[model samples]
Target: MTGRSQTEDLARLFAPYESLAATLLGRWDGSIAEGDGSHDRSHLMRVWQLVRRIARGEPAADMEVLVVATLFHDCVAVEKNSPQRAMASRLSADVARRLLDGIGWQPARIEAVAHAIEAHSFSAGIAPRSTEAAILRDADRLDALGALGIARVFYIAGRLGTQLYDPDDPMAERRPLDDRRFALDHFETKLFLLSAGLVTPTGQEIGRQRTALMRAFVEDFGEEIAMPEDLALAD
Candidate 1:
């Protein structure tokens, strides 16, 4: 097959995945409360972009499995610290399986997609066993870093009535880091450590850069809010 024809064929094969994503997103629109913007349709789409990029770097990655998994990875969004947080991915996997079965996806393909979704969440604590699952996990975590990650942190914190930082101990020098109370605590608790957990080399490189950006912002923020005593202590 010619290069152009191969490209066309690939596009034709991928079109339905994109269509299903859009259809599901339309149904999800406005169903979530305004404050839950962090896990909205846009987030899923961004993760899809990363999944494509990461999949390109993995010769054995199953694109169809990755695409379907990315679309429904967060089909059922829950609060960060909710009691059901760990079950979110499993619920989403079930939803994706039912939806894929309805659309006549092969049993093997549906199982692949379901496993990828089930293993994608940080809270779920399930290790990814497939290339597609690993890519999905890395893609989702990548969104929780960099400038966009900064915006999401504050957005969710504001919605939950959390402070920007702990006034007395912004870096939590004397206390345990609690992201539920201060947005900045999230950097120390989670965001800064994501790169180490990434499975793909492409994702790890991107994650390293984004993590640095988050670290720089945290340093700048600390400087901006430093008290005389804090500055003196640093000296």
Candidate 2:
């Protein structure tokens, strides 16, 4: 989707929290528009969808917190391969705290939002401490699975100029898995393992479904690339 369309969708999705959403969209729209395809507006919209879906089962979650957290979760864009990638969520939470505090949100609520934003990142290695945080984490990670996740893996690889896979050893039977150098290796490196780490039951169920799809894709991908004798297709 075009950035403008995605922004419009975000405006609608967060319509209940219009004032805060407007403030964020106005300030971050340019950055989001210029960001890599994997972390752009469409990705936010998808995460919002998952947040709502997961929240239904997690009735204790604070929607306002989810709303603001989703809006600023990736406010600070860092490339996946950057040394600073692990700090991206922390940096975004800091920005969210400043913005929400400026808007007069209560300290506790702002902290809730910030925590959700901070704990949502896979690279951050922080355990979620609240229902909102767990839901947001699961929601965001859900976007990194399934068909959408597959597309993002390659989209980011193209941005980094990485090969589709290491042609000599596509499955990395000898070489270590290096997603920075080969896109397909990312499945085993992270994507394939995401479902098992999901926090919410709802998110876990959906994650399992999506992960199955991704698994099938990788199996097919393997068959197409590997030599006949080397192939050991699953029964």
lDDT tens readout by residue for model 1, 124-191 = 88999888989999999999989999999999888888999988788999999998899889898888
Where does candidate 2 have its weakest 10-residue lDDT segment? 26-35
Error of 1 at 76 (Å): 1.0
Q: Which stretches of candidate 1 lie over 4 Å from their true place?
A: 1-16, 19-35, 229-235
What TM-score does each of the candidates earn? 0.84, 0.90
Tens-digit lDDT track for model 2 on 1-235? 2365556666676767766676666555235524577887678778888898999998788888998899888878888779999999999999888878777889999999999999999999999999999999999999999999999888888899999999878999999999889999999999999998898999999999999999999999988887666354431
Q: Each model's C-alpha lDDT? A: 0.79, 0.86
Q: In candidate 1, how many Å is residue 221 off?
A: 0.7
Which residue pairs clash in candidate 2? none
lDDT measured at residue 226 in model 1 versus the true structure, 0 to 100? 81
